[model samples]
Target: MSKAEKTRQLIIEKTADVFNSKGYAATSLSDITKITGLTKGSIYGNFDDKEEVVIAAFKFNAKRLRDSMDAAISKEETAYEQLMAMLNFYKTTWKKAASQGGCPMLNAATEADDHLLFLRDAVKDNFIAWQKKVSTIIEKGKAEGSFKVHLQTETYAYTFIMLIEGGILLSRTLNQITHLNTALDRVKLIIDQEIVN
Candidate 1:
């Protein structure tokens, strides 16, 4: 990458945690500079404004989370096992995410709902994309005989996403892992009793 490109990425990397943790509206220019140690001229030299930095940082965090989960899911031999792996992966990785300021997508979505209108569509698109991934997995499971045929892939996909995100929200807010575990447990139960043949 060019020097400017590398610097841009550096800024995003440094600011990701602050953006995810403190959020877009609340994160000030000083916060970005504090985390990144970049002068205002250098930051403005790379991006248009703090808005650009927040968006880039949020995307970086979301992509990192997605890549990690995708890597875990890819290790399983079957679609059923893959779904289970995802649940377990969440249980294992959530603490790390919480420490970094909870799920980036969840944090962005919550902030976008009432405050950051600029981020609303990006967060919406991310949710839609995630649901599509889950639906694709359910479809694969059906074809491979791991999941029951004729099940509503879209519905199951939506439920899984909802359960996971809801669980994260409650667990992070309540400072209790059981709420997240219970939500994940519910997802597994649904898969076992309803989705599996």
Candidate 2:
């Protein structure tokens, strides 16, 4: 990568957590500067404005999460294992998520509503991608005879997403993992009884 590209990436990596933690509206240019250890001029030299930087940071955060999920899912052999892997990934990553200020999708979605239209769209796109990922896994499971053929894959996928994100919110707010764990447990039950053949 060129010097400018490297610098831009560095800024994004450094500020991603900040944005996730602080939200786009709450995260100021000064916060970016402080986190990145770059002068305002240097930041502006790379990003056209705060909005551009925020968009890039959101993308970076989303990709970081997606990559982690993909890696976790890839470790298991069966569709059931893959689904469990994903739920376990979230459960295991709770602390990490807390440290980063909760799930990026949840954070972005809550703050994006009536705040940043661009960010709202970005969050929407992320959820769409996520829903597709989960639905694909469920569909594969059905095709492979590991899951119930009559199961509505998309419904299950959306419900799982809703449960996970809502659990993250409650857990983060309470500073406890009980809600998140319960949500994951319910998800497991759904997979085992409702989906699994």
Candidate 3:
């Protein structure tokens, strides 16, 4: 990468945690400068404005989440196992993430409601992509005869996304991981009994 691109990426990496923690409305350009140790001129040179930086930071955060889930899911042998692994991965890693101010999708959705169209569109796209991934796994499991063929894979995928995202929001709001665990437990049971053959 060019020097400017590298510097821009560095800024995004450093400020992503702050943006995730502080929310878009609450986070300022000064916060990015503080975290990145870059001058206002340098930061503005890389990004057009605070909105641009916020969008980039959110994309960085979303990529981290997607890559982590892909890694964890790729480790499993069976599609059923992969599905369970995806659900369990969230339950396991969510605590560490809670300290980072919770799921980026939820954070972006909450903060960008009715504002920041670009950021909200990005989060929505992420959710749609994730749901498609889950649906594909479910379809594979059915074809392999490891999952029930009668189940609605698309519906299941949507429900899985909703449950997990909703659980994260509830857990973060309540300041307790039990809500997350409960939601995940339900996810486990749903997969084990409804999907697994």
Candidate 4:
């Protein structure tokens, strides 16, 4: 890309962890400059303000998590297997998130509540997208006579998201992985009983 765009992306990539670890309000322009080795002029030249950079950095981190999940899910042969694979992926990857701040949706939702409309919208959209993906898999399973036709896909999708996100939050807060593992095991059990024929 162009030099300006490249610099902006570099800033986002470098500061993603900073924003996540420090939160938007606490992360300063100096932190961005320190991480990116870019001058204040270069940072301001590309982003309008700290808010803008925080939003972009959050999006960057969130996209990385989403892409990883997509890759893991795509490797499975069936919807049920895919769902299980996703939970397994979460169990393995979540430890790394401690250093990277935390789960993006959980971090954004807590920080953006009743403030930062753009960030709130982004988190909401991420949740909706995730639900839609789960629902699509459920529907596919139903069509293939794998999942029960009587199942409510939307509710199941929402519940699944809630469990996973809540699990992450609780596990992180408690500084224990067992909570996450238990939650994921429950998720796998639900998928097996509800989605597999």
Tens digits of per-residue lDDT for model 4, 25-127: 7788888888999999999999998888978988888888889999999999888788878888898898898767788878888888856666887778888
TM-score of 1: 0.96
Clashes of each: 0, 0, 0, 0
In model 2, residue pairs whose N, Cα or C atoms come closer than 3 Å (at least 3 residues apart or on different chains), thus clashing, are: none
Winning model by lDDT = 2
Instruction: Kindly report which residue stretches of model 1 are placed more than 4 angstroms away from their true locations once superposed.
Output: none
Best candidate, TM-score-wise?
Answer: 1
lDDT of each: 0.90, 0.91, 0.89, 0.85
The TM-score, computed over Cα atoms with residue i paired to residue i, of candidate 4 is: 0.94
Worst 10 residues of 1 by lDDT: 50-59
Of 2 and 4, the candidate ahead on lDDT is: 2
Instruction: Give a tens-digit lDDT track for model 2, residues 1-197.
Output: 99999999999999999898888889998899999999999999999999899889998899999999999999998889999999999999999889978888888888789778878888889999999999999988988998889987889999999999888989999999999999999999988888888
Pull out the clashing pairs in model 1: none
| Residue range 132-172, candidate 1, lDDT tens digits | 88898899999998889999899999999999999999999
Q: Report the candidate with higher TM-score, 2 versus 3.
A: 2
